[model samples]
Target: MTGAIGKPTPYIDAVQKVTGQAMYADDYKFPNMVYVSCLRSTESHAKIKSLELKKAEASPGVVAIVTGKDIPVPFGVLSISRDETAMAIEKVRYQGEIVAAVAAETIEAAEAGVKLINVEYEPLTEFFTPQDSLKTCTPDEQIHAHTKDHKNIHKTAELRFNEPEKELETAKHKQTGNFKFAGVTHGFTEPHSAVAMWNGDETLTIISATQVPHYLQKNLSKVLGLPLHKIQVKKPVLGGGFGGKSDPFPHEMIVSFLSKKIKRPVKCTFSREEVFITHHGRHPTEINMSLSCDDGGKITALDADIIIDGGAYGSFGVVTSYYNGVLLQGPYLIDKFGFRTRRTYTNKHQCGAMRGHG
Candidate 1:
């Protein structure tokens, strides 16, 4: 391959990454800075009847306590779907869904504070898989208010470029195959961490471990009810990100909200298990390929039916649907083609776009 536009460049931060001293979100510290830990729900589905934070606020060394009520704005990565919040409003739709958060003088104090905040729940039936969703369709099937679901299904689609039915009927050789793909976790040793500080005079500064600084900044503004210019979000050196660190997470919102409430800096660091439970991995998918070949070497028809297991929330599930169906538009071409795909919500850790997405 000849030199591409703006010839291939070397790794921009290769040296810094290789060296052990590159500063990340957790490396920086300031005076009176407090650590925050989320009090997440243990159930996969439920209605949050009550959230009591008095004990957390009164805990030893506790500086402040935060819950969904502290931050009212609904924010999300995609501007179109601002359905997420700093904490679950009246319900916990997933197992790791945040119900409240606490900030304290010490890291251990923060963890203790979170445990003090009690979260009450009224259990609801869970949707564990996409197949179960298809079998049961209803207007009230979705777990969330702002989701595109015909029953538990999140998104459904059908696209055709040619008459696959007619071509397949006249084809000579035909074969059908079914396959499923698993998911992946980022395993970025740095842990999902964030730091937020109120820059006095109605402004906020958020130092986040995120790939999309601009998006996170916008989300913080919406979550904190601050103007765009009033808040600044910076992306420090990242240990790693294969899409997991790209989206605006609840911890991100929690820290920002807590900072605004206490008028001080706040930070949240998720444990390894918390990381997997809070966010998402790859889209678990099923593919049905119907391919037919003509008498000669020419291709006749190819049809694909795909379904994606989009866990809990609609976290990048829409785009995953495209990748699941469109990626087949590849290495080979056929005379006729048809593609149909659907993504349904399952009460499991969300299925997001990961490395090599499709």
Candidate 2:
């Protein structure tokens, strides 16, 4: 069983996964387990006015009700942008952002609790595209406070070598084009699911369908205020992440927090439609690309300016912003190259890594 670098090799766990013998996160069961349901915001962008949980707390079979205030700390895959909480805090930047969660004896009870919870919101201006973000607005209108001068821009990545503009002007042959790409979501086979339990010794365990268990472990420690040794993140047989499950999800944090508070196992699973709402797929982009060549058709210079929409939270947007320009450095030889990529915040599902990042 020897193979060269380019030769095909069998995946180590292909047999177990294909034969339906693999244990997925949802397959795990614990005694006295409770089901959790999350209440999501319906507004694209809004400030949270007030939340009423009296009805939800009194709902039949509802054991515990949690809100953003319970787990207020933010966590993201990238350290540069940790701006997502287990639930919406003072505001919700996207329509589907979770605002509340309930754990109950049965799934039906959890659903009932979800319907009982009431939320009041004051709608704010929404930025649906990169073009909208380029326009300056008041500080209160900006999606995030970090953006300077009331801008919605999340990141601006630039790289330059030599003088591409000067070379492009001297080149005899040149080609330029405009490109626009709509955002896309990963259509993984199985929806996201997780089961969390609190160990008797004040430790927590999370079994989830995730692509990066180590990342989740580190984030759980940060969000839960617990030591790394006190938390364990296990990735079970995954149906296919396609980079969608790479980030530590809010649902995972919600389940873990609820279980610890109630001293019982808590499980949260997403429906197919809900999975679409939790997208972190390809970024929607507007690009201007120019390539210059000599009379002999030899490559001279290349330049590009790209504007990408990074909705709601910055999942893997910082890396995505760099990859949009940096990945263009290739096997071909070129004397001059330049690129500028601006990733802006939009009021929608966030965009992150996918099959082809660039």
Candidate 3:
């Protein structure tokens, strides 16, 4: 305990990372490995009218093509809200949602095959802001069918102690403010990548650059219809996560399913743009807050109403919704405190935990 208590410590993998000896997920190569590329949705909110894959199936070096129907099970980090799929099924809620994937001998061939696939979409009314999402819309216009009351509201988190709102109205010294924050991405150096191998024993092994391997494994089993013991998840050297790589991504599921279907190894690596598109970062938030203090500057009460844009899918939004208001209960001695946070589903990229969570 003497040497460990007050000494300056270095990261365990510092030497390996500095010398370029670290093996990231994309660095691994296997015999007969296939590369995968995805075809993404162009419309923010739309139904797939028609998807034509004949040209892509006949493309040079292409091994296989898989759509959402191949693996249609839904999963998410939160147990109560498992609303995300490996790929968009009948309709796409956001732009850049994966619709189909192509596996081929080479990365170039996979990308070329992806370009040959044709898709037609029937556009729907898109909701981009939290306010727009809170309003009631037709069932057909709702971003997610699970949302209740014909609205796009995903989760509503409320907590109260001592009825702070009553104190706010009567306080001698009170302040009220409205704040808005734009959505932010983690901007990690490493782009998302995954490699899946179908083993000889009818088992699956996946190597990925992710922060949550257990969640990835659980979702993989749910989507692939495999037992948890039969699937193995490995986390290689991650460049950086900052909570961006925490979610079980669509590409990971796509590669794993394709590998199992083709009985070979499959890998997918995202470009920077794809990384941005796939990330579940900090939510865009709007907060209306009021604080009351006594004449002696003692904090008496605090209250807030928060609205967070959760985007297309529920990624860790239920927890985030609670944190948006609960995190404000500290650093001051407040007798009365109350908050209500509403998380809404919008036609944009999903938002989840970040460096500081909510």
Candidate 4:
């Protein structure tokens, strides 16, 4: 172990990747391959009044179009909160939520078909900040119906080891601070891509650039109404993940459903702009922390109040809410420690796992 510590270990696939021999999801092509383009919502928060896809169906080279009704099952990384549909269902919580999708002979035709679709939405009250999200809103204004007390709070994690607040008040030496951190994106080298093929034997095969294939397979079965054994998920050469690609994404399910609908290969590759819109990155957080120390310089007590802006759907937010508080327990022994983390839903791209778990 000591001898290998300073040695440079080359990546197993470094040669293949460097020589352009690595086959990525986008690089795979089939004989009857179709392309998919999604029609995203324009409003940050709105109820979809009407969706007209007749024009898109008649668009050049267009084969099929699917909305939320086609794949109605909801899915998320955590089973406790499966709130996201493959496409926007009754309402669009965020501006870029996928409302519908178009499958066509070519990528250009699919994109053109997407442009032809018309959707009508009734505007709703939007929550953009964690502070606003903490307040109770009307049932209609609430981002998710499941939220408690009509508030946009997704998860509230609280843990207490001892009386930290009491200890802080009595301690001679103590410090308190408030911090605000901006949200960050992964900005991986390659945008997301997926290729789905419906085999003649009534099986489904999906090649995607993702880090969690098992979760993707499970979600695909749930959304597509197929048995686990009948579905196969393959991971090709991924450009980068950094925990951003850990969730089973909507685009992956969109392409899979489209392929099964038309019984041909279907592919969807996100543009650079789409990549940013599909962000599952580090959360925008606000924290108020207090700590106490004795004259001996050993930590006595610690406490924190944290708020994380979890935009739109609940991805891995439940776990993230817990991680934000529990992670502080390590690397130090503070007998009295307490924390409360509130994850709030907002009108923006969803935040999830990143380089750091929380």
TM-score of each: 0.91, 0.96, 0.98, 0.98
lDDT of 4 by residue, 1-358 (tens): 4688879987899899999999988899999899999999999999999999999999999999999988899999999989999999889999999999999999999999999999999999999999999998999999999999999999999999889999999999999999898899999998899999999999999999999999999999999889999999999999999988999999999999988889999999999889999999999999899989999999999999999999998999999999988887679989999999999999999999998787
Give the range of the ten consecutive residues with the poorest summed lDDT in model 2: 1-10
Per-candidate local distance difference test: 0.79, 0.92, 0.94, 0.94
Candidate 1 residues 1-358, lDDT tens each? Answer: 4676688777777787789667898887888899987788899888888877888888899888767877778876777545667787887778888888778899899888888877778887778877876665554445765454347777777778779877777777888899898766777777788898887687888888888899888887777777899988888888788888878888888888777777888888778889878666788788998888867866678889998888777767777777777778688776588888888877787767677876
Count clashes in each candidate, considering only residues at least 3 apart in sequence or on different chains.
0, 0, 0, 0
Mark the 10 consecutive residues where model 4 has the least summed lDDT. 1-10
lDDT of 3 at 343: 98
> What's the ranking of the predictions by lDDT, best on top?
3, 4, 2, 1
Residue-level lDDT tens digits of model 3 in 237-349: 99999999999999999999999989999999999999999869999999999999989999899999999999999999999999999998767768899999999999999
Clashing pairs in 2: none
> What lDDT would candidate 1 get against the real structure?
0.79
- Scanning candidate 3 in windows of ten residues, the lowest lDDT window is 1-10
Best by lDDT: 3
RMSD in order of candidates: 2.9, 1.7, 1.0, 1.2
lDDT of 1 at 171: 73
Task: After superposing candidate 1 on the true structure, give the runs of residues whose Cα lies further than 4 Å from its correct spot.
Answer: 1-19, 137-141, 146-150
